[model samples]
Target chain A: MKKITIDPITRLEGHGKIEIFLNEAGNCEKAYLQIPELRGFEQFSIGRAAEEMPRITTMICGVCPTAHHMAATKALDDLFKVEPTSAAKKIRELMYSAFQAEDHLLHFFFLGGPDFIVGPQAPARERNILGVIAKVGIDTGSKVIEVRKRLRNVLRIIGGKPVMPSAGLPGGVSKGINEEEKQTIIEAGEYAVEFCQFALEFFDDIVLKNKDYVELITGDTYQHRTYYMGLVDKNNKVNFYDGLIRVVDPNGKEFAKFKGQDYLDHIEERVEPWTYVKFSYLKQLGWKGFVDGEQSGVFRVAPLARLNAADGMATPLAQQAYEKMYSVLGGKPVHSTLAYHWARLVEALYASERLLELARDPEITSKDIINLPTETPREGVGVVEAPRGTLIHHYKTDDEGILTDVNLIVATQNNSAAINMSIERAAKSLIKDGEVPNGILNMIEMAFRAYDPCHACATHSLPGRMALDVNVYDTKRKLIKRLQKNSCTTSTSGDGVGEAVSNT
Target chain B: MKTIILGIGNPILSDDGVGIKIAQQIKERNPDLKVVETGGVGINLLDHVIGYDRLIIIDSIKTGDGTIGDIYKLDLDDLDASMDLTPSHGMNIATTLRLGHGLGYDTPAQIRIYAIEILDNTTFRESCTKEIERQIPTIAGKIMREEQLCAIHTLGSPLCQPLQNRPVSKPKPRRAR
Candidate 1:
């Protein structure tokens, strides 16, 4: 009897390991998705000035600093018991929209696009952005780069920096966009909307049109019936910056809707001994393990969840695209994980439209920003829809305005339980009699990638690149097979990067 | 010739900030060089490094076998074959360079990557390990000498910017992470 361990995985945000345990009869017994936790963020945050949170938290993950910055800013506003002026809120939302547009565009094209555009069965080498360019043409590649540059420029204009935005403050943004900056943002927004529309069309022509790919999207292996969560405006429209946190049942009925401060009342984190990442579940429903369905407490977030938790998109063009997605998918609450890509594009369109609307607002240029806090600092909660999903930042400050305690239930953590469940379900349905099928790794990865889960945010790492490794074991728990990709075993004495090892 | 010096790392991540620290020093010493700092994202790195005739990238890397503060200066040919040229799912620095070349991005023909082996990167700290910190001036000095040699060879060329000697300023806070 032996236990096989695949310690590090590749092609993800952090180290994720998949362990498949076989039964005595050589059939798949169970599977576990384990994530390594980076330690001490909470401890490190203590004693820091509350004002430094936006800057410090953004340093956690280079990928989604904007989300943390926004969440922290909103939390500061709540903590100080101050309300930003109208212009401030609009400007915050404007920067947020740009962030979403840029992030979603990258995820769709560079991160998630290769899977569909290049075909899932394509070799590891070909299943990437270059492969996408080869299929879509080099002109399309240039356009992708061009559009991204413009979007980031808008971010730079608003946030004062691109990668890590510093515009957000306790009651408002640190800076306001003038006419020229507003004009640039508007142009970028228009281009983003057009590009996203084109992206949706491209998905339809390439992925939806192909019967095999469509089957893959609707296939049972990729489907999971789970509760969905997101942030919605008063009218139940998808809102990225500020909104009430909403939860919908598997059947698309509103289960609970509450303000940002009331999250703890609705959600609870479930800890497992095997991993550092905590699984969040509906507090009222209680912890029901990893099982899905109406009774299960495990819930999902990000694009599909957002689409399900809300009534419709706030913008007209996005609303149309949203309706089309639902009609094609056979109605609300799409459980198919593959559909996340489509939903992401739809949201991209919505974000772009929102960016334009905010940019065009007459008061957007007003100097009335930042309402100084007069109340004593205590505890406050702030939530925003990160490009991935609903992100909640809760903080408690001392009387002197120093951070005393901090708790973050990031969007990915909300989907942590469901992500594991999805992976196990895919593994069980696809792996037969201990036989690993072609594209099995991709199948498992597809489950997690849909979430675009940032483990780097949840748990930190060095080199900050995620490595994924999958290990299979026999009934006796003996090591059987290993598959690795984008791994970092390279000798860093600068000879070169590491070679990926794929072995069975 | 037009040249760019880039530093890549999470500045708050202890030893990982070594690259940025060195880049800052180099910027101080050579006011004429186009130096910038960034988190290690391939596409973003590509944006900054493109269109340059030469690029010198300073980064902190973890080589299990290397000692703390050891520096490795490497060229493109020195890298391994598995480092794909196209942008893959998680494109690293090597992949970004390859992608730049593949896309006909006018990528720097003369490029060097100085990887400083680090002992600690997991912790959240503003400073680096003392050992790595000690090497900052030496690394910056080395890079400056290399740039000077290149400038001397390329002097009088229309593409080359004028070289100037000036007193170094105190390091200022970086706007980027």
Candidate 2:
């Protein structure tokens, strides 16, 4: 027997690896996704002041700081047992909507959308932002960047977009928006709404109208009947900022609806030996391994899941987009993972519309933003629907308002099992008779990338800016091949963006 | 040229915060130079990066091949010329600058990237490890000197002073690790 190890895989953004095992027949047997873990976060937060969490948690991941900040602030509100004033809630939601809209748009243009915009089977070199720009025209990129700059500035006002202290405080925010600031938000919101509409039309023209792409989306290789989880408003409409957590069965039937404080009662984590991530499953369904369907406990979060778990969008244009999606994709709970991109577009539109609505609210410019807390501090849990999925922040504190413990279940963790399952299913479908296609890595990556799993601290994965890794083993557990896609220099020198290498 | 120093890193991720720390030190020494510290996500970089004639970006990178505190001055074109355009998950600096130029956003003409070799970026601690923490003043001074570029002296701004002789007090940790 022989073995080769890609040792010390650390320090890349969203650093993850896939290992595929082939049986004696040389056919794909099993595949697993492994991500490096960020250490000592609970220990790091144990002694911090309770109120500082809103600011501190923002540092958890540079990518989703606003999501974490919003979650942590809500947790503080619970800890002090005070409700935010009406104006404060609207203000917070306004900033949150901006964050979600900008984040989703970025994902569509740069992260996931390229797979469709540039066509999946295109040459590997032509499958990134530049490629997307080429296909979508230079103005699309310019529009995305321009709209994103405006929306991002609005997000910075509360979540410390430029790395200032957190403006979020318990019971409410620290301050209200002035009339001038509200005008900027309104204009930015309108611009985002227009861009998202254009984006949907682009999708309709490129993906929906194309027969081959439609078949690819509806194809079983990218489909799953897993339970879906999301946060929804009182009317069962998808809500990003705040709402009751909802879960729906594989058949698109309502299963559970609970507040953030009761999350532990409905959801639980299963620790697997092969990976550090704790895969989340529905508590009532029990742990049923990595299989999907009603018997399986595995549930998914993020765009597709949020839309599947809700009735409709809260805003009008988004509601139309939602209806059109279901009508075209064959109704509720579309099992196709590729539909996540479409769902992401609909949600972005909703977020933009909601931002405009809030921006226009008369109370948005009111001075009564915060309400000071008077209750004794203790334990509290906060929840918010991040662009990726539902994010939960749990905190326990001493009587003096100092944190005693902190636990976070980010979007990636909640979607971990489904992500792994999606990867394995794709690999199983793509590889046959022990023959692995050269393009199998991208094909398989498209499945999990749909979930946009950040692999937790993706705060930093300093593995020399590497992107994808795939390893294959034979029945004897011997290394057969290794494929790596890296754009980093091996040495501390310039001009060495290494090419993809495969060894057998 | 209106210049700005854009420091990029995660503040709570040990060595990853090195960029922010060095940027803060540079600002403390010369308040006249505009400094903005950010995690540098996607097009957000475009916002802080545009409207400046000259831009300096300092970030932490772990090639797993350099001294923990060593600084590497990188030109914009030296980046992965054909890779996906994103810093972490958004657009990479080179592609972003290209996009800015294409969009006619008044992007900086001269862009210098300072990548500090880092250790222990995976940890949740807000401060860098002791070894790297001890070298902050030296690293900050070196970057400031290189960035000053003699033009600031002609502008009547204070010269870049060696910070090694300045007070050697570390910021108080939220709690001892």
What is the CA-based DockQ of model 1? 0.15
Interface RMSD score of each model? 9.7, 9.2
What local lDDT does model 2 show for residue A476? 88
Off by over 4 Å in 1: A1-15, A457-464, A486-504, B29-31, B77-90, B101-104, B134-177
TM-score of 2: 0.89
RMSD of each: 7.4, 6.9
C-alpha lDDT (0 to 100) for residue B82 of candidate 1: 35
Which residue pairs in candidate 1 collide?
A2-A477, A8-A469, A9-A467, A9-A468, A9-A469, A10-A467, A10-A468, A490-A498
Note the chain A TM-score of all models in turn. 0.93, 0.93
Please give the CA lDDT of all the candidate structures: 0.78, 0.80
